[model samples]
Target: MEGDLGWWAVPLAVLGGAIRVSTPILFVSLGETLTERSGRINLGLEGTLVFGAMAGYATAVMTGNPWAGVLVAALAGAVFGLVHGLICSMAKVNDIAIGIAMMLLGTGLAFYFGKPFIQPAAPDLPSIPFGWWSDVPQVQAALNVNVLFLAGIAAALVLHWGLRATKPGLILRVVGDSTDAARAMGLRPAVIRTMATALGGAFAGVGGAYLSLFYPGSWNEGISSGQGLMAVALVIFARWQPLNCFWAALLFGGAGALGPALQSVGVTQGYYLFYAAPYVLTLGVLIATSSPNRALAGAPGELSITK
Candidate 1:
């Protein structure tokens, strides 16, 4: 079993897979972090992610431009976020329920419209080859990093800085902390939240674009695999910090790659158990960090979960 992949290649495979798989999670979690910072949770990003995947793939296939597809996917995601924000801004709407509804709606729309593009091949996003200096073929393959992954890292750094140093960031924090204070300051909480959610959705859409236009490079109904929903838990694990979100995403990605990495090294024993590593890790983190007596440290004061 190990004839093809040397034992030495196992760590390399795992590291490579972690970087590849974590890209989507990083983008989605960053988006969710932004939304949560505005005191709102968007559970429907799963649907948005799937929908964006479909839209991106279809656009690439039709236009023969992967970047265009990414843009369209972001727009589609923004539309979904805008709808969610508008509905949640109403007096009696439940953000969670509305998010669920949006998820269903976006997913349904994607499946319905994406049927035609499923069998067609779409243009793939380009990658940066960083393993040219290595003589090993496996090393070369492992280090062929996607452009989106690098962009996600840059985004994390920019977001972390922006949130801590920018005026808009301050406004968002204030609005998230207290609606009453926002009102007293003549700021519109609903509008601020709506915009934030839209921006968040755009980020998620880009993540979906990466999925369809890069790694897996395909459009399918089952492509997401709960990554969108998992991102919500990831945000909590990160304590709503963008930098933490980046690290948490990489950790989750590493857990996800454990099984495949083990198999590469001929360690197929209990392979199925390895497949469950990511979920197990997430559950363990949630359980270990949870507290019923108080909100999580660093959580926004106006977030529904905190109340």
Candidate 2:
């Protein structure tokens, strides 16, 4: 009835929008965090992300099942990750450069094949009406959280725990810390890294699926809007902690929601500028956190940034 809560609506909308907007980044950052944790980095996840979006949308359209699309997306992402991992495992290979190439390749493939699905409508993933109790339409709208966002949160918690308490996590950390040490322990660093990278890619694919199956729900080449590449900065900002990635995703999500939130309240003065909030926030964080004398506290030792 009375959705007119005046100024209060802005923050409420932002909160809802933040949860909605954060899902993809949350998934991508979690995936990238795992990749980095395993002592490898994939700049190509942006590509994987786009490809996943295309695959998921196409599948959903064909099957009339949103879940099927998500599954296919994850599988497709794993393939991309597998390729990236294999290439980077080679001696003297630069992960960043390879990542860039993969990004272009993924985008190219999506654009070419995604043409047919451009106009087709697909079933969207469902959302939880958390604000079902609210009488205000804005509150109800804001509280309609997606299931993937919940999954992302659960995933973050599980990842954080798994990293600290699991045997495989220990081995991964050992490999990530030093190839020599891992070798001495009779572990295969290349293989481990490759697997980690692939799993990470799967995570990224789910993120892409969220895009096409949910918020801004559709198949498009530009759906990702660089959220995949920003995974690196997000991971860095989160200090490689999975739980932190969750919070960071929300922060980024809220920043990205500023424009729409303000516009809903008839504040369009700096609409375009508000849309850039996430980027500005990212740049500010990077600049502020950067240091010439010391390395990031918890960065994997084998990661190039730490070196």
Candidate 3:
């Protein structure tokens, strides 16, 4: 029984950690997938994530309602995305550069405005206690599933279906594939792109809310841990597919859980290296998938980097 316990614990811990840690990535990557499918890249989601964390935390602190906080975070994220979309819509402006500027601006504003709410306690998002059937304490703790994670999964399914079958999805794909074609079809590419970007930003904000209002369950400058940035690469690694994003997020989440999972079982050597696993995996995926002669399969034709 003792030997069996040792063998099973760490994997179970990682299983739980993967679900917990992957929620943010799932949201952010889904959002980025939407934006990229519309032929725009918003590198500023990192800033949006941080700002959303601050706004969500602050709102929850004031309203005493975690749902309200999630709403506010989504709104704030939309505003950031709108700004990026508007700026990029202008002629002679570079989308990537504008995205970077927005990232810095969003982060700066979050830091500046969020200073006062740092120490306040806020209500946290509720979780579903799926592990109630388990007698093991670790199993119970690991099975405490957040509602947002479930929502994200539902979203992935909806997006995958919508993109493949819906009219709006067709329009987005058309615009992304060729701006000239969209213009010929009387569809304003800029308007479509802007809307997509804003919607994407709102998704990212919700991801941020999950971080500050649930997992880490605190408002602080260090809350994001670059999940926002990592999401961009995740979207690419998933080959721009929404369902693929879900699996990639879990993989990344499991990678993220490596150090802590090992530690839970008394294996803590090279702890920092384990923590770095996600980034390393990301870099490796990018290198393997990258092509010098062409854009990635399924990548939008009008995307700046691809061009």
Best by lDDT: 3
* Global lDDT scores for all candidate models: 0.90, 0.91, 0.92
Q: Candidate 3, residues 1-307: lDDT per residue as tens digits? A: 2253675887887888999899999999999999999999999999999999999999999999999999999999999999999999999999899989988998899999999999899999999999999787788888999999999999999999999999999999999999999999999999999999999999999999999999889988888888999999999889899999999999999999888888877787998999999899889988988787543888999998787
TM-score of 3: 0.97
* Backbone-clash count (model 2): 0
Cα lDDT tens digits, model 2, 10-107, are 89879998998999999999999889988988899999999999999999999999999999999999999999999999999998999999999999
Better of 1 and 3 by lDDT: 3
On a 0 to 100 scale, what is the lDDT of residue 244 in model 2? 92
| lDDT (Cα) of model 1 | 0.90
TM-score of each: 0.97, 0.98, 0.97
Q: Model 2: what TM-score?
A: 0.98
The alpha-carbon lDDT assigned to residue 166 of candidate 3 equals: 98
lDDT of 3 at 3: 50
Worst 10 residues of 3 by lDDT: 1-10
